[model samples]
Target: MDSSDTPSPIAEPLPYAEVTDPTYAEVAAQNFTVEEVAPDTHVLRGTCPRCNAVLEVPLVGNVFHGMRSIRDVLRKRHTKPSAGDRVEPVICTCEDAHPNRPEGRSGCGAYWTLLLTTEAK
Candidate 1:
């Protein structure tokens, strides 16, 4: 067929759906955790292993080498905290943390605690 006679391909638009608030399940699937460390301070933890940086919520302060999982503890890698850092336990959904999923999601729960630490000189 001649170039001029050839029909051009038509581009189709992607089907769109209205954006809605994500359900607790969806957010939970994303593994979002909220925990209170101290008065006015909170923690929002994620599943990313490299997310070792402990952030003090509401106050927006951060402390390196904060609490970590047993897996992280066994790894025993040295991490340093800057001038303003505090160590707080991770809030997670694990067998050690909660006996059962309080929200009705079979195995979901939160474990929040303070991290025992030896500060760097």
Candidate 2:
């Protein structure tokens, strides 16, 4: 117990940056996919392209969809997508940034991108 305990600290949540550095060798880059639930709702799931660990980001509840009609769609889902193209900002925020560094687990902070899809949608 210290004097600092009396003053609580408030800070931003984890996954601070929207996207991590791509050049870094250990940035835990991930491959993300967007799932359109309804018309304006979506869930972004990022999986390490070559490893285990999945991060799901939900874009809904009138935050990004602050104002949307029931008929709004993404026009076109990602077609012929590449990891480097459709994916940009990705980071590894798994398990409190992996302080303990679990074994066999890829808390390694590497980087990846979306899977390359070659199809006409």
Candidate 3:
């Protein structure tokens, strides 16, 4: 198997920038992948569609009910609607240093909400 032949998750690297936009959330929804690390616990992993930096947001508690209110999701849910799915706000917490990024802050300064689903154990 040739590693070079494998497709990268991020097609191109984007320079870090400190900004937040709802459009980025739409792109992020497509980029993120969900992984169940434990019972009722999951992690949303993906690359920032804005800055192309890696991101991971942990989710705990009831996936559908206790995560966030539907009203909040509606406000932050910039992406297409997914019926019966829970929306969780995700922020870029990547450790990579970006130029001009504020001190004490991590990642490229991007945040978005992702539609998450739960499966019976």
> TM-score, each model?
0.21, 0.32, 0.62
Off by over 4 Å in 3: 1-17, 64-85, 117-121
Give the least accurate 10-residue stretch of model 1, judged by summed lDDT. Answer: 13-22
**Which 10 consecutive residues of model 3 have the lowest summed lDDT?**
65-74
Clashing pairs in 2: 26-109, 28-109, 28-110, 29-110, 29-111, 29-112
Alpha carbon lDDT at 26, candidate 2: 28
Instruction: Provide the clash count, candidate 2.
Output: 6
Candidate 1 per-residue lDDT, tens place, 7-35, comes to: 99964422222122323223322444445
Write candidate 3's Cα lDDT for 3-118 as tens digits.
Answer: 99898785444446766786776676566666667787867667887777777778777644333322244453545655556656777888876777777888877776665543
RMSD of each: 14.7, 14.0, 7.9
Q: Is candidate 1 or candidate 3 better by TM-score?
A: 3
Clashing pairs in 1: 63-85
Per-residue error for 5 in candidate 2, Å, reads 52
- Measured by TM-score, the strongest candidate is 3
Tens-digit lDDT track of model 2 for 1-121: 8897787786433332233343331222223445667764766665543234576655543232332221121222234534322333344545534334555553435443322222222
Ranking by lDDT: 3, 2, 1
